[model samples]
Structures are given as structure tokens and as C-alpha cells.
Target: MDPADSHTDEIALSAEEFDAVRAALARVTSTGGGAQAHSLLAQWSALVDEVEEGYSWCAPELDNDLSCRNALAKVWPLLPSRVRAIRQPELDCIDVRYRRATIPWPDRPEEGARWWTWRVPRRLDVEAAERRDPDWPLGWEMMPFPRPASVEVVTWQYVPIRPSTKRM
Candidate 1:
């Protein structure tokens, strides 16, 4: 394990990673186990019964999805088994789903809108994709899960250029 992979009591990660890691840690500590996420990493002892190593909370994106993938990997080790963190890049948000909801989350990028739509993962009981509210930021979404199961979307507002790769 990279020492960098070892998170400490000091919250040293980038803001996005820190927010994500903390939120995930909240889930683990809340589970029946008498655990506390004093550090982003629960002791390896605490994870003995968890899913295999190199696990992450989000669905793995493709090799070329750079920025978010880098941040996601850093938070992966801290996640409890069964909570999935999903990325909706176009909307500049992340969606978290705990195992309690076992449906297929949305995989499609939203379409035909002036602003990006923030879609509740289909797997979730929440509403479908809709235009983002003013509070949604540019590049982050935090879901606390179970209690107030909902997404808080943060994104950088912009219109990205869609370069056509095919020869016209």
C-alpha cells in the first residue's frame, strides 16, 4: 500500500477527496459495527469482512476519464463494502448509493438542455434527471445515504466543446 494511500487523522487530501472520504467514512462508522472513522482508513482489522481490496465506492470509469478518476481512486480505500459512488461527469456531479438500493443507476448523459441536468440515479427512489438548481456546484455531489438519502450537487457551470472526431 502506498503510504499516500494511508489516510491519517489529519485531513490531508484535496477538498473533493476529503469531502468524499469523510462522507464514506460516515457510512462505515454508522453501520452496526462499533467503529469510528477517526482516520479516513478504518483499521485493516475493521475491514476483514469487507469486499476485496482495491474496491471503490463508484463505478469505475474508462481509462481516459482523467481528473475525476484520480480523485476517486484516492477515496476508494476508505469506502465500506456495498456503497457505490457514481460519477456523472457531464453534470459535474457524483451519486452515491448504499447497498440498500439495488437497481441499475443511470448510465446515460442527460440530453437537450440549456444547463446540465442533475439526475437521481435510477437505482435511487429520487426523481429523474432535471435541470440543476442554483445550489448545484461545478464538480461534486455528496450523498449521505439512508437517513436523508439524497444528492447534493456541486458543479462548475460551463459549456464544454464537443469536438467531432468523425470526418465530415
Candidate 2:
């Protein structure tokens, strides 16, 4: 992960992955596992804390979508086999479902809207998507899924973008 990405807002973990990390920590701590296990457990515990504080509780921007993926790539290989085997499919499932929800319409982008609206369908059930992956910085609709397609539509509103005050 980039050192600059350490901003609290840039960390994310899916609900299932967070739960798996907690469960693995509990098992390892209770078993009094050795040095390597303790090290891994500690790292995972910190990650859990970061995710809970950074993404779960805080309201993060939806436009940038790689925070969770970048964070996970660094830590995933270190996770225990059982946790890895169990969580991969669950995460993949969510990715698949969310991807389906985001297919675009075949027509050109709507007037006064960014390209995101083209990828994410109109009138998406935001609440249901949030329920599916509450850990996402924004709802699942904000995720940058691969290969958008043409899908149906619903109600949509176009809001004007404002300039940011913060200096880069």
C-alpha cells in the first residue's frame, strides 16, 4: 500500500473479512499460538480497528473505489488458510452481485450527469446494497466493478459538483 494511502478514510474491509479476522484472532489468542501466530493476529487486529474506525463508522467518498482492494491485497496473503478459504468466495459473491447491479444503459450518458450514472443504474436499491456490504465506504453501487453492461433504468437526479477547498 502507498504510504500516502494511510489516511484513515482510505482503509476498507468487507463485513465478512472483518468478521473472519476477528474470529481468527479470538481462536489464535485463546489457543496461545506461537510468535508467528501472535504477530499475524496483532496485524489483523490493527487492520480490523482501522477498518471499523476508518470505513465502517466514517462517511467516505464514493468516487474513489480502490481503497478496500488496495488494503486487502497487502494483508490477504498473511491471513490463515481457513479464513482465506472461507472469505474469498463470500467476497467474490458480493462482487458478482454488485457488478450485476451496475451495468450501464446502451445509450449515451444522460444530460448533466457524470459517467458513473451510466455504470450504476438508476433508482438502485441503495439500502439493500448497504445491507449486503455495510463495510463499503459508500454503498455497493459506488464500487468499481469490472465490465459494465446495458441494463434497465429508474428515477435519477443530477447534482452539480462543487470545488474542493482542500489543497492537494
Candidate 3:
């Protein structure tokens, strides 16, 4: 287990916990009055339990397609607005591995659209690595998981929206 890995895991876990807390808060506020706070708390706890059970096997299946995306989506709403905006709204599941590759935007070539790429780093386990590799390698101090990386965002280049003129 590398220290970097531990840190990454910590960050990811913290984010997950934060989201849970936020959801509880939102649920409480949705009721719009103090009378329902207690009931909402009970429901919130149950919801948390359900979420935990739902993701119990998430770590092991991080390499799988749907599972990985589901995990990502769990954290998606918690992400900063700008980051969330970068992703397509309709995308339900995203493969972490596939997201690491460069994605091409061929639909808007006229406006000089190019490829977009991003990499989400993997979380590391520091303690496990120490037992396996006595001497930690350079760059191992960094988080094992890839951080969100992105290419230049194409603000606007939609051909469909462009006006076409024909001789009258």
C-alpha cells in the first residue's frame, strides 16, 4: 500500500461521504418544515444503508463497465459545476478506462473541433505497497488514481445550429 494510494482513497471516500451528507440535507430541506425533520432523518439513514449495500462490491468491480460508471455517477453530482458541465447530461454510465483515452469530436470539423481527452487516476494503497516493495519508487508519492484531465473545451461548433442560405 503506497501512501499516495491511501491519500487517493481518502479523498475519494471523503467525497463519497460528503455526498451522502449533502443528500440527507437536501432531503430534510425538501420537506420545507421542522415537523418532518425527524422522519426525514430516519429515512435518510435508511437511504444511506441502501446506498452502502448497493455499492458494497464497487471497489472490486471498478474495472467493469456499468459498475464503474455507476460509481462515477454517484460522485458526479457532487463535482463542481464546471466539471459537471463538461460531461454530457445524457451520459448515464461512463467507463473509467475509456474516459482516460482521447475522445474525438468529428461532428464539428468546420469550426476546427478536435479531440478531447481526460484521465481519472486510480486510488493507491500505501500500506500494501510497503510490504510488497520495500523501496518506494519515485512518483509513487503522487496519488495512484489519475486526476481529472481534459483537453481544450470546444465552446461552440455545432453545424446543425449554423444557418444555411439558398438562392431565392
Candidate 4:
């Protein structure tokens, strides 16, 4: 079902609960998150999804915006602390640099044959050559387009796509 179309019950929470969740997100974002920290972050993110299911904290009367969900969406993928997003024209997408990694950074040689490269949704696969940081957002993982096994797929599928009730 389209998330925008589903009408869920209001998420009930007190100020304290809100504060706790916010603090947890902040803590997870600011420190070297251990396994326990990652676990807490997962739960906290889920709470954000639940709380904003049918309501937005940014504007209470606003049915047009899902502010709470949007905030979590922005933060969840690119945890503010562990990764630095650098947009690279080479990859045609943002190359995420992890903290405490090598200094020379991504060792990929800038000079490469253009025909040998490809972009799968975002960054070129070559840019993600190193070991992935455990904390990197799931969405950051770029996969090969047109799987060798199934060469028939054509268009990309999207989620929560805007409905065409009013017509484009």
C-alpha cells in the first residue's frame, strides 16, 4: 500500500517520550556507536516512523507534510556523524567518506576509461571499493544495474510515488 494513502491511528506520546527519542538520535549520531548503540538507534528510528505515521511534529494541522518522517528519512540513511558526503562528478553521485578511514581516502585513480564505468542509481561501483562501514545507511549501497541473471527488467520501481488524483 502507498504510505501516503494509508490512514493510520494517531501516534500518542508525551513530551518526555519525544525528548527521549530525540536525545537517543542525537547520542547515536554523535558517538562511536557500539553494537548496543546501533540497536538503540534502530529502535529509535522505528519509533520515529510510528510516531509520524499519521501526524507530523513540525506542523500539527499540516496534512500536506510528513515532517517527522521526512526528518528521520534524511538522518537515518546518512548518519550525521559517521559519514561525510562528498558529491563527485566522476561517480555522478555522492561518495560517502567514513571517519577514521585511510587519509589518502578513496584510492580510486581519477583517470579511467569512460566506457568501462557505469552508475547504478548513484555512485559508480568502483567508488565503493573499500570495506563498507557498518554504520553506513542501507540505501547507500549501490548495486549493479541490469542483473546478468535477469536482463529483461527495464524501468525502476519507486515507493510512495505521488498519486495522480489531480493529474500531472
Which candidate wins on TM-score?
Answer: 2
Clashes of 1: 8
Q: Write the per-residue lDDT of candidate 4 for residues 67-133, one digit (tens) a residue.
A: 3323333344444332212111211211111111111113334334321122111111212233244
RMSD to the true structure for each prediction, in A, is: 18.6, 17.0, 21.9, 18.6
Full-model lDDT for every candidate: 0.31, 0.39, 0.31, 0.29
Candidate 1 structure quality by residue, lDDT tens digits, 1-168: 533233333434556655555675454444333333332122222221121222122322211222223333444566443222222221122121112112222453443321112223222111223223443222223422221234332223356799999997
Report the backbone clash tally of model 4.
0
Single out the weakest 10-residue window by summed lDDT for candidate 1: 90-99
User: Which pairs in model 4 have colliding backbones?
Assistant: none
On a 0 to 100 scale, what is the lDDT of residue 119 in model 1? 29
The CA lDDT at 40 in model 4 is 34
Q: How much is 116 displaced in model 1, in angstroms?
A: 43
Q: What are the TM-scores, per candidate, against the unseen true structure?
A: 0.19, 0.30, 0.19, 0.20
Position 11, candidate 4: lDDT: 34
Residues 1-168, candidate 2: write the lDDT tens digits: 532223232225577755655554444344322223224423434433333232222123322443334334444565656555545554444334334444444565533324333444322323222343323223444444532333222223446699999999
